[model samples]
Target: MIQQVFSIVVPLFVIAAVGYFYGSRVRPEMRITNQLIMDVFMPALIFHVMIQEDFYPSQYLPIMLAGVLLMLGSGVIAFGLARLIHLPWRGFVPPAMFSNWANLGLPLYVFSLGDAALGAGVMLVVAGNILCFTIGTYIYSGKLSSLEVLKTPVIVAVILGGAFNFLDIRLPLAFDKSVEMLGQIAIPLMLFSLGVRLTRASWKDSRAGVIMAMFCPMVGVALALLLIELIPMSAMHQNILILFGALPPAVVNFILAEQYQTEPDAVASMVLIGNFFAVISLPVVLFFVLSN
Candidate 1:
């Protein structure tokens, strides 16, 4: 577990450090650069990651379903934690609902378990994205920020990708090759955007935010581990799901908070702190999980 943790963490930290320094150094139109990344680079990466890989899930459906249910279940657990703690309704649910499944969870899964587990993670990510953009947005709208049902990139990406997947259709090889080339830009750019966004925000030691950050992912990681045990799964597959839950807070949480005006600062703090703290927490959770 120590080796596995270091194997993943070391490379990620180095790349993130590079992004931080590079973003600080570059003075070129930041917004334009971000837009280029979001509109072109990241999407290509997502699409490429999904399509280029062979999406075979002979026994993965159950795990995928478990991942979805785990997230929804975590939302309930998170809300209970909040109510018990008695934080304001406005900020509490968003942070809890906005999981770190996509940005942090997916890539790490792909890296750790190869493409098959990543496909499972992708399904979970899509379901989470739907919930985040739709129901979660409903809660945040008129309270924190405006909610537009159709304007989310995650949703758009899923719809297009899913349609093709469901129908078992493939794009032309030439076009697919072109897109694959473009998709290579996704990883570095996604990491770079994260660094740039983090740079723009300032972190404060908000007690409530820190507390929620500690509570939320812990519930998630615990549930995922329990599911791995109770549900019949191979050792390798269980490791994949366990790691997904152990991931840091999703950057989308911060974006939703910023969009809806819920607890952007708090969300930022959760992400900034949650990620840094994951160096310790993830290993702790994964140790019991993997050993079991």
Candidate 2:
């Protein structure tokens, strides 16, 4: 079990470490790289995965529903915690509610659980992104950004890919390979960018960061436990749900915070600390899931 966990976890951190070391030394500008990933690579990956012969978007709907519940439940709890401690809800709740399902969770799932897990992973991203754009955006920007959500490349990929999947349309062989190749760049790039992003983390809000670093996974796992008791799902799906809960705060939370002029610093702190802490939290979660 330990070997299995190590095999899965080490590769991720090693790549991230490479990115970290390089980022620390050179401090390369990442805006264009991040933009390319978002605008091109990630969408290709999603579309490729979505169009697979075995891919059935509807089969993952239950997991997506669980994801929605997890986000909402986390937000509710975060709201209470923020009010109790007098932290701004705008900063705290978004980080607490949304999670790093993309950069960390996607590759982690595929590594630990194998290729079959990709569908569930994609659906989970869909659920997280939808709420992040709609409810999470409203929390910070004071307006429902529904249209903005539609404009996102990832979401557009999901829509197109899902439509193609449902219609049983296959891309021409050469074009399919092209899309797959493009898609392949997203996961590693995501991890590397994550490492680069972490370089910018300020410890100024370390207390809040520590608080959430601990809270996010625990809350998610707790919600997953509750969800499984109420919802019937396959064992793998159950495990997926549990891991979904254990994800750290998404880096996108900080981006959104920055865009909305919210407490970007605090959000950055929470994101960075929460992800670093995931080195421990994820292993424990993986052991629990793999053992079961």
TM-score of 2: 0.98
lDDT string for model 2 (36-96, tens) is 9989998998999999998877788788888899899999999999999989988999998
| Residue pairs with clashing backbones, model 1 | 100-250, 144-260, 144-261, 145-260
Q: Return the top candidate by lDDT.
A: 2
**Leading candidate by TM-score:** 2
Give the per-residue lDDT digits (tens) of candidate 1, residues 164-241.
Answer: 766777889998888777766666566656665566554774666577658655777778778977788777677777
Each prediction's Cα lDDT score?
Answer: 0.66, 0.91
Residue 113, candidate 1: alpha-carbon lDDT: 64
